[model samples]
Target: MCSVEGAKKLAAYQAVDNHIKSGYKIGIGSGSTVVYAVDRLAQRVENENINIICVPTSFQSRQLILKNNLTLSDLEVASQLDICIDGADEVDCNLNLIKGGGGCLLQEKIVASCSKELIVIADYTKNSSLLGQQYKKGIPIEVSPLAYVPIKKRLEQLYKGEAVLRMAVNKAGPVVTDNGNFVLDWKNFDQSLDWNKVNLDLIQWPGVIETGLFINMAKKAYFGMQDGSVKVQS
Candidate 1:
């Protein structure tokens, strides 16, 4: 049986192997699982001598790219990318994802939009039949700091869920994203709700920056199973 970490690595390695190519610009997503993806990317660069440009989705991802000695670029430099290999907080049956557990949803979505294809890689634990079935963190919403309070209140009333500002583990207050926005985790909402419609509506709000509900964005996904196998879904 594959441990959780092993499964993550398996999915990461396989995704990198299958998606990445020389001369291609790539989007590096943020999160713990993405750490393993960077590791594999570094290995391939070292062994295969493949030259690729990395566009980081967060501060953490930039650090990973720098640490790995990978050539790092930005959207301004490489706005068009070949593909994006990312990890999802939760991947549903239709490949809809609940991302931004790391507070990088805004940038992640932007980079993914610039890319031609979005590839999601994850462990078995993150693979679910429904959006909130396995991941309990809820949908992450990036909002302007000045309007977070009002946005949170409005969203809570609109959707029956505990909408709380996500606090930092080491910092004093709310988790400020790389783009300097606050995050609200809408927890325990109706799972059967139409996320596509909700996401469209939420983004139109005054203070909302982005929502974690990724619909029709990902082209394919790789799930590393506990039984030491990889499952490809498209």
Candidate 2:
């Protein structure tokens, strides 16, 4: 039987091999699971001869690209990307995602949006019967570093949900993002959600750049199961 790690590795490798095209600029995503995908792509680097510009979602991802010997480029220079393969914390049947668990959601979403196609590679645990079933930390909303107390209250009143300031579990104060922002993890949904309305409502909020709830973003998804099975959803 294949180990869980081995299964994840196989799934990522297959996803990369099947999707990546020659001469296409790709967006390399962050997180532990995506590391496997990068590794697999790296192994074929010599043979592909592709002029791929890898846009990283975080410092860790930048290093992964460098370590894998993949070409890296800034988003300013590389405005258009061919594909973006990333990992998600949770993905519903409709392909709505809950990411940013690793705090790279801001950059990840930006890269994904810029790319021609966004493909998500995750373990089966990330797949949910419905939205928010597997991962329930609430959608991670990154806000400006300014006063977020009022923003939190406004989110509760306007959106009818709980917005809690994300604490720096590793440090002393609030968790600061790569863009020097703060993360507000919203919760307390008493009923089924209208994700479309929620997305529109949150985007209009002041000081909010990107929310963790990624709706209608993914073009394809690969879920690696424990039994060495890979499920593709598109």
Candidate 3:
């Protein structure tokens, strides 16, 4: 494996071994990094016989659970989760994260809210002192398809950044989220602004579903370093 891929695997495996326990309900997150996390979870179930019910945060996550032959539950059955292990686009020093680079932000945040603790697993390149310092994909904003234009214009006017519809490379139109909502990548925003307040404000707006900004949510983060050591930040 390449260095980055190796790092991601290391972090995911470590996070699973450290946080997951027998008879606990876990929230599975989306994206490439999470793929490794699921692999580790499946291994633990098979080798150690550690039984756990997995609650998926996205369609991709649900598929992963099924493909791994791990027991799967929905929010209705498992409203409260023991812990959530997810990946981030960027993780700041304060543990703030910019997620949803893969259009799974809405469900990811919902599942996180239901979990007791959130553990972010990532590669070293995703760690930064600020949200936009390393990751440049921008804050993903899941919005109503009908009001995307107004929300885009309003966000640009207030935040002084570009909000573009995320397009699908393989598909013909914009990238539709699992919730069937369109995503607006609000890039180049003022990094100095209070993200906590910004997140609250954004959620209250009409046609706004959820933002990629995960402020004051994570309990801790584990970053797989280039040298193959895992770095833990809380």
Between candidates 2 and 3, which one is better according to TM-score?
3
lDDT of each: 0.93, 0.84, 0.94
Candidates by lDDT, descending order: 3, 1, 2
The TM-score values for the models, in the order shown, are 0.98, 0.93, 0.98
lDDT, model 3, position 73: 98
Give the worst 10-residue stretch by lDDT in candidate 3.
1-10
Q: How good is model 3 by TM-score?
A: 0.98
- Write one digit per residue (lDDT tens) for candidate 1, span 1-234: 999999999999999998898899999998888999999999999999999999999999999999999999999999999999899999999989999998999999999999999999999999998888989988999999999999988998998888889999998988888889999999999889888899999999999999999999999999899999999999
lDDT of candidate 3 over 1-234, digit per residue (tens): 339999999999999999999999999999889999999999999999999999999989999999999999999999999999999999998999999999999899999999999999999999999889888888999999998999999999988889999999999999998899999998888888899988999899999999999999999899899888999998
In candidate 2, what residue range of length 10 has the lowest lDDT sum? 188-197
Cα lDDT for residue 85, candidate 3: 95
Alpha-carbon runs more than 4 Å astray in model 1 = none
- Kindly report which residue pairs in candidate 3 clash with one another: none
Residue pairs in clash, model 1: none
